[model samples]
Target: MELEVKPRIYVVRLGGDNPKLSTALKLVRLGYAVRIHAKEIPPHSVVLNPFSREILKPSDSALLRRYGVVVLDTSWNSGLEDLRSMVGRRRYEQRVLPVLKAGNPINYGVLTKLSSVEAVAAALYITGFKRYSLEILSKFKWGLTFYELNKEYLERYSSTKSAEELIKVQNEILRSMGLQP
Candidate 1:
């Protein structure tokens, strides 16, 4: 394999919603040939990731196959269902889930409240995060953005979080994300 920067373009597909598809398609239209790898997706948007093998249903996969997209259902069996071998789903998961999860305590309403230094709020939430992990998602929520909630979720825990502090963190996170009350 040859070395390259941003070797492939990835699209986020969760069950049935792909908010970034339009953005990605727009990029494609601008002359960027990108490779798409999605998880779950909604109907009507099948035409977006026409070449992805990592899709939701066998039937949908077949339809996408016609468009050149491959379908590999991660639910039919146990164990890690990885698309990296074919398209690289791991990269997308690694890139988006952490931040999104960390920011989960915060919300759309809380986002607006974020202080001038967004990093401070983010750091406050992710502090002591020597390690972390992410939650399994069935679909992508637009509120989380491309990085998910806070990006801090991508690591394993080195220390445990306190219930009180966690509550405070959660509240702060939500407030920062713009979730009022």
Candidate 2:
């Protein structure tokens, strides 16, 4: 909604029947420029990590516009382990998404821990592709619900001009939720 940058999207799937994978499939079906990799991904792509301390914000949009976006698809319970085992072997600009409420069945209304689709959508939203994000979510029944639940936080992160400002806002929200930031 902010800019017209259309960078390619890539998903490194680790064999999961999860919503994240479902969303990735939907993204591919929707004619979005998406590449699915079951093995190692390209080193130049900007990767998303649930364990990273670097909260993604509006400032990262330019980088994504230039290098594209990458999401690692794995099971929620084994996310860190899977990412570490798989991603640790590669070099990527890893970043975490800002705080958002989950709308998925397993973790609905929960903070920060988003499903694969939600994480990708959040990144897309913060990086000036709000419409595209919504479009991706539209493929599923709960997609709009996820967007509505985290709309405020998504907008705030998307509006931030710098990573520091985004981090400050993210910290405030997390603190209010009694979450360890």
Candidate 3:
């Protein structure tokens, strides 16, 4: 009898590399299917990642087709240079601003990404507003914590545990900018 072996395949998610990839893999390695992404694409059908096109694959395109294409572009081949172009006249002012102030891109150098969004929100709240530590929100399962929704934050926005919840979170984020908790 003859035997054949196939090389194991791994998918390195698009966008920025995820540090927790290994940790996540460890939890469900056997008899499990996993999806990992480097950056988060907004609610869109198509994404254009001019930078690091290598990350895009046939499967990526297929997966993206599910959404309505909230994000038209994914990354810049020269990401930093692209960022530089985006800043332009504001270049000097940008350096002085913190990562959070720079805007909410899923891939912001070492800044917080979608995986870290929930805890980052907590950190932002703790450090910038309540002047406390974010020991609580850190334990949340998602990028945003459902229990921590303060009255003020929920006032302008609504809440839910389903897909619709994303809208509320997005709304709260707009108002939460620079204000902290």
Q: Which wins on lDDT, candidate 2 or candidate 3?
A: 2
Compare candidates 1 and 3 on lDDT and give the better one: 1
Candidate 1 structure lDDT: 0.28
Q: If ranked by TM-score, best first, what sequence of candidates would result? A: 2, 3, 1
Compared with the true structure, all predictions reach lDDT values of 0.28, 0.76, 0.27
Tens digit of per-residue lDDT, candidate 3, span 110-143: 2222222232232223122121113323333432
Better of 1 and 2 by lDDT: 2
> Which residue pairs overlap in candidate 3's backbone?
43-70, 44-68, 44-69, 44-70, 45-68, 45-69, 48-74, 51-76, 51-77, 118-143
Runs in model 2 with CA error above 4 Å? Answer: 16-21, 38-40, 86-90, 178-180
Kindly list the per-residue Cα lDDT of model 1 for residues 43-154, writing each as its tens digit.
3232222124332221222232222221222211221234233333332211100122322223342332221112212222232211111111112233234234444331
- Per-residue lDDT of 1-181 in model 2, one digit per residue for the tens? 5677676788776654655446665666677646567445555566888767567877677778877888776777755677766444446677878778989877889877687778888888998988878887887789899999878888888888888999888888888888767
Candidate 1 regions with alpha-carbon error over 4 angstroms: 1-4, 12-21, 33-96, 100-181
Return whichever of 2 and 3 wins on TM-score: 2
TM-score of each prediction: 0.22, 0.85, 0.23
lDDT of 3 at 43: 31
